[model samples]
Target: MTPYEDKTIKDSLREERKKLKDMNGKDKLWYIWEYYKIPIISVFVSLFLIISIASAIYSNRFETALNCVILNSQFTSESTSPDDYFDKGFRQYINLPEDTKIEVNHSMSLSFEESAMNDFTYAELAKLSAMITSKELDVMIGRKDSIDHFGKMDGFTDLKEILSPEEYEKVKDKIYFVTSDETGQKVAAGILIDEADFEKKTGLLIDGPILSVMINSTHKDTAHDLIRYMFGL
Candidate 1:
């Protein structure tokens, strides 16, 4: 048998150490790299993968109950984060469990004006469409132009279908209707918010903000509740 094939792990290690001990510094480095590069690289790769998986698992440990998007709105103060105000308020309002999570995404911005359309605007629009298609988006709050843009695309659920009679009656006057592109009929696509009141409550500044529920929301009931919560109804 060949010497390599006959050597045990210990014997091979000993022989390697003897060779390394006899070598110059540069030669030892080259020899080690030549002999152990694959194992060394494999170890690092395995560690990286393990850490990545662990981080992902830790981040996703909590169940996501609601996902709301607030487009084109900025916080009143630099220190005011979504988690500190809006998310916390909604969690308290609904008495959500500690283990459950609520996501309020306010970073995305889009403009409906042809003159304002750019790469960023198109990217945000694509992201919004993708979220709706995946049923990951529940509620949307934005200005009339933004709401109208999505409403015309059939992005929002008709309020009449989801809200109870009493609930409908309460916000009937505040409803924002849009023409459905497919049905060629007016649908209650959004609810107009009292921007001043909303600003006071959430510390977010938006002009003529309107709230709408996504058509394919997995959490329709929570989205309905969010409307009432936002309006303080």
Candidate 2:
């Protein structure tokens, strides 16, 4: 071989050895990403699409802007002016104060699976994980399993702290509370809706699911107002 060709080969081998040395010292996650980049990219893409589509839907519908994000099994509320609609129909809006005229907008997301311990996949939790990580979630209305799942994630605010003394007095006896043992501290992981209210509204006498605020919610006041409106407080 030519002298210049020999030098070029040695330089290339030195660079390859240095790269190998660096790669050997890389963290576990770096190696995992390198090996599973395609799947990781797909998961993130799906999560981004979910968030983007939800954002688009919210922006287009609520020009007044979102007051909260509700992650529920299903969304039932559609009429933005429910107070006005019910007011005209049942003459009940007058019961609410004039200050309750806030235009509360919500971005809702459905659960990926029903059970927290079931055959749920990582991709299923992608949207939820992303939302919580972004600190954008406000309210979550869901079942005990979901509450337990998120409560373990340590992202949900303690409802006991959020509810006022008077309000808690009214609701304390109505709903059921689920306690979670976190670092030896017993925290409320979930709360079922008032059985009387559920039966009155849905005609189902069974005890129902829960609704709680997110720990990182930006619109706590708005969330509280919506809750008051919902429970007819």
Candidate 3:
């Protein structure tokens, strides 16, 4: 009501306004936090949940690698095992765009014939064969019996379609071509084993383990990469 009191009050209000106008970054942030705290907390919580779910899904898919399988005659060598050859000296061997476990223990064995030195239990092999038919199988590495059995069944993919020109040249000598009964057309069945142990056993490069991708494979990109890798590409 009085002039002096009113002037003092106006001066105080002006000072507060100037302080607000000249607010620093920290002060500005605090102002936002105070006014929109509830919404800010909600946004962060939603983001946290989204990230968590995405991480879990990625982890499961990455871990499973969609049932990468290898049904083969069991390895029996004095100097090395198939497991060592694959899992060891492998991680640093190549830098892939995606991370694969490259494991060879349970991942590599599926019982086709107990007579062929297979390690897979009956139940396990049955499950694997189901995955193969479903096109969930990523890769299959097997010996002649298994390869012949699967290839004739039209279970394997033709490598010719996926191989680059240079790649075809490298593997042309190594791959086996078979006529699938269903299509009556020739396709690559598998790659012969080039490992040293097999050579030592036979005293020469002969038919051995064959690596292949499936025709209806879901992970076709990764499967192609693996078939190329079989030839050291």
RMSD of 1: 3.6
TM-score versus the correct structure, for each prediction? 0.79, 0.49, 0.56
Question: Least accurate stretch of 10 residues (summed lDDT) in model 1?
Answer: 77-86
Provide backbone clash counts, one per model.
0, 0, 0
Model 1 whole-model lDDT (C-alpha atoms):
0.87
lDDT of 1 at 130: 89
Residue 10's C-alpha lDDT in candidate 2? 73
- Candidate closest to the true structure, highest lDDT: 1
**Which has the greatest TM-score?**
1
**Alpha carbon lDDT of residue 39, candidate 3?**
99
Q: How well is each residue in 52-125 modelled by candidate 3, as lDDT tens digits?
A: 99998887775433345555444445665544444443334444324566544334454455575344466666
Q: What residue runs in model 3 are displaced by over 4 Å at the alpha carbon?
A: 1-67, 75-90, 97-100, 103-124, 195-207
Minimum summed lDDT over a 10-residue window in model 3 is located at: 198-207
Report how far residue 217 has shifted in candidate 1, in Å: 0.4
* Residue 95 alpha-carbon offset, candidate 2, angstroms: 14
Model 1 reaches what TM-score against the true structure? 0.79
